[model samples]
Structure formats: C-alpha cells, structure tokens
Target: MNLADIPLRPGGAELLPVRGVRARQAFDNRDWVAVEIPVALEFNGIAHAVMLATPTDLADFALGFALSEGILLARGELYGIEEEYGPEGITLKLEVASAAFARLKERRRSMAGRTGCGLCGTESLAHVSRALPALPPGPSLSKSAVARGMRELASLQVLQKVTGAVHAAAWCTAEGEALLVREDVGRHNALDKLVGALAKSTLAASTGFIAVTSRASFEMVQKTVAAGVPLLAAVSASTSMATAVAQETGLTLAGFVRGDDLVIYTHPGRLNGQPATA
Candidate 1:
C-alpha cells in the first residue's frame, strides 16, 4: 500500500505569511478542514470496531489496531490485509491466523461479560487497568533528545495543522528528528497508525520514543507496550493509573512535554539517553 496515496487530497501547503499585515490575513485563511472517513476493522469475518478518522495511511491503521488491541503479536503475524471503500465507510479486512482469531473471540467475550452485554461494554476503573506485558529494554535518551522530540512533534502533524480537529502521534529518533507521523481524530488510533507504519517501513519501534499531541492515558501506555516501544512522550498530562501501568510495565512515560520541560512519572532511567535500536 502506498502511504502517499492514502491521504489522497492535499489539504494545503506549509507556507509562512508575509510579515506584519499579511499575518492578519494568514489568520483569516486559517480555517480548519474536516475530513471524516469511516474505518471498519474486521477480524476474519466479524467486525471489531468502526472508527471515524481522516483518510490517510490506512495500512498502518490496520496493523496498529491489531497490535494495539492485542490481536496480532507482530507485523509478521498479520497474514493479509485488504482495504475496500464502500458507501458507508472504508472496510479493512485483516486476515489473521486461526490462533489469533481465537484470542480475539476470547477478548470480545471477556469484554462482553464485563459490561454484562456485548453491545454496551462500559469499562470500569478496575477494567481500565489491564495487565501489560514486560517492556523491551533499550538505551536511555538524553535530555536533549526528549526536548528536541517535543519541539519537533507539532511540525510533523500535517492533518492537525489543517483541521485542528485531528490528533497526531510521532516517532522521533533518540537524537531528536521526527521520523514517522500519523494523525487521526482519535489519539489511540493515531498512535496505532504510527506503530503500524513503523512496522511496515524503515521506522524502528524499540529504539526511538513516541510523542503524541494528546494526553497520555493508560490505554496509551498499553498500546506503547504492545508495540514493544520503551518510551512515550505526550503534550498533555496523564492519569494516575497511566503512571502506575507505565511503572509496572517498565516503560518510560513522560507527559506535558513542551520545550525544556517535562514530567517524568516512571522509568526515568530509560529517558536519560536514546534507547538502543531493537
């Protein structure tokens, strides 16, 4: 799948305004563009979730959804994927192995029982804090790297710059360059898309830390762990449970990542320097 072809329409360009009076006009032209597309994730023949997102690198979205939801162990575990656009939404048929299908079914059943119904599963506080696998070990990033990553994150979000309605997830190298970026209306979906893209491209998941233009929540950390990434950076704050899960999972969670400032809740050692590439 060509990532280039996914975001079919060029939203706009990144040209700066002329100085003084032109800046005011720049503000006038700054209207958010809304692109709503339906993303249907189907496991085998059963549909899992239907999301409203901006149409972009969907293959990454599929891979990320599977891995983040614990549907697939790794990119290699995903057997085949096909994208078909229908009148209602874009359906992604992800073919998983039988073993994976069984696990997905079990997950759905568990979720159903928790909410007392398959259709209306409301996650309670207890259910929100789920078990996480051990985090992969990596090199510690320097303070400079973290600072650079946060500063560069905003520039990577193409959709958010246009729509102001999308959230973005970026993969920044240990040194500070923003590499892969994914944007969606849902922060989790954005992160999933980034994870999936990293798996499908030259992007490395283990070494560099991830940054998001949204709050760091428990589910966010869960997705990071599922990708085997060692560190996560967020522009906003995190919940208490999120910090707990990060500590337990051995992930370095950093929140409120702005220029020269960050709050480290767990595994500060991992953020000291860039992690070794896995």
Candidate 2:
C-alpha cells in the first residue's frame, strides 16, 4: 500500500494564537504546535498499551507498534485495524492472528503513554530487551548517498517544519531516494510508523537504510533490526546501549550525520568511503 494513500486524521497540528512579549514590547501572533493525544492500542479486544502521539498515520502507528513491541510476528499476523474516537481520546482496535494474541498474553506489559519513554510497561528488567536476529547484509551506502539522504529527510519532515515539535523517520534507497517517511511527536513512534509502512509495502528492506531526525536509542535500533533493515543513521548521537545492541545484532549504526560527515559507531564496512585500517 502506498503510505501516501493511507487515510490519516487531520489533528496532527494546531495553530494557537498567543501574545508574545519581549523587552516591554508585546505582539499577538499564532504558533503551530504538534498535537498529542492518548492513543490506546487494543489487540483482540484486549487493551495492551497506550501512547501519546500526533494522532496521524495511526494505522501505521498501530502496525509499527505491534512489530516493534513484538506483539505480532509479521504483517500477516495482523488481520485488521479499526479506529474509534471518544471525548477522552482515540482507540485503535487491532485484530490479530490467534497465535500472535497468545504470545501477547504470555508476555503482558502495559505501556504508560508518554512521548519520550519507550520501555514504560516492563514488569521486569529481563523484558526490557528482546532477542533480535542478525540483520542480513544490506547494500553499501556511499558518503554522497548518506549526505543526500540526510538532506532529503530534513526536507521531507513537513510536520517538523511546521510545528518544530515532531520527529521524523525516513527510508531511503542506497542512491538517496526517500521511499517512505513518517513523523510523530515521539522519535520511537516515528520510526515505528516508518517500519510499519515499509512492512506493508513491497519495498525490499535490504536495499536501503533508515534515517531519523532524533537521537538514536536502544529501542530505535531494536525496531530497525526487527524490520530487517541493516543500517540505521541518526542526525544526533546514539546511546551507549543502542551502539552495543547494533554491534551485537550486526546492524550498521551511524550517528551525527550531517553534510557529508557521519560517525560510524558499528559495522563501518557498510559505508563506502571509510578509510581502511592496518
């Protein structure tokens, strides 16, 4: 399915008129702010987790959350999604395969909705991390390709450009064409939305890399590897745990990517223009 064809709510952002005062000077103006609402994800009529999101691309959010959270093994495991709105917030009811529901029941963790927290509902520390398979070898990206992709991703962040309060994730071809981009108030949610969109399409994950506008975290790396994408590049620094996980999972991790420069934290061989060491 083309991500552009997906139906989304119009509440991603709102413009509010406000008065600004600077050095005894006052002016009235309007400011665009990203909208965040409590979105509940229910699997098979069972409430699983709730998150604060921009309330757009929700179907993508639901599918991405399922994959990143390990609730569903594959896209086929999700049967359908229905949206319900109420005074309180929106609810996404997901119908999944019976086997997936059983697995969800086995590992019960309810997330408390927040923009910055990804591992909020863990019952134990052991559940914080999941076993991830090593990603298959992906196409090597050139320095020019990485630089171009970052520039394109920055331009594609329409929501961020408007509100300046949202993060974005983009999937780009090795030659720097952006295939899909998703934006949300939360960095993790943005990546999840992108992953879900990729999974639903016929795009080959091994042919490209995922780029983000936020700092890379362990959960971000986990989501990328879960989607079988071999490379993840971030515009900011990555966490220690994220770097470690990327190394263990054989996923190439790059950070601080801007204008032809990037720091390869793990699996540097995936990038073409790296200096050979003795």
Separate clash counts for every candidate: 8, 0
Candidate 1 worst ten-residue window by lDDT: 110-119
Worst 10 residues of 2 by lDDT: 1-10
| Overall lDDT per candidate, in order of appearance | 0.74, 0.87
lDDT of 2: 0.87
Please report the TM-score between candidate 2 and the true structure. 0.93
Look at candidate 1 and tell me the lDDT of residue 259: 89
- Cα lDDT tens digits, model 1, 58-108, are 888899878887778777778998888765657889999888898887666
Q: What TM-score does candidate 1 get on C-alpha atoms?
A: 0.81
Residue-by-residue lDDT tens digits, candidate 2, 1-278 = 23233234566887667798989999899988788877899999999888888888899999999998788989999999999987667899999999999999988996786899888878889898999887766566786787788899999989899998999999999888888999999998999899999999999987888999988899999999899887888999999999999999888889999998899898888786432221
lDDT of 1 at 200: 88
Every model's TM-score:
0.81, 0.93
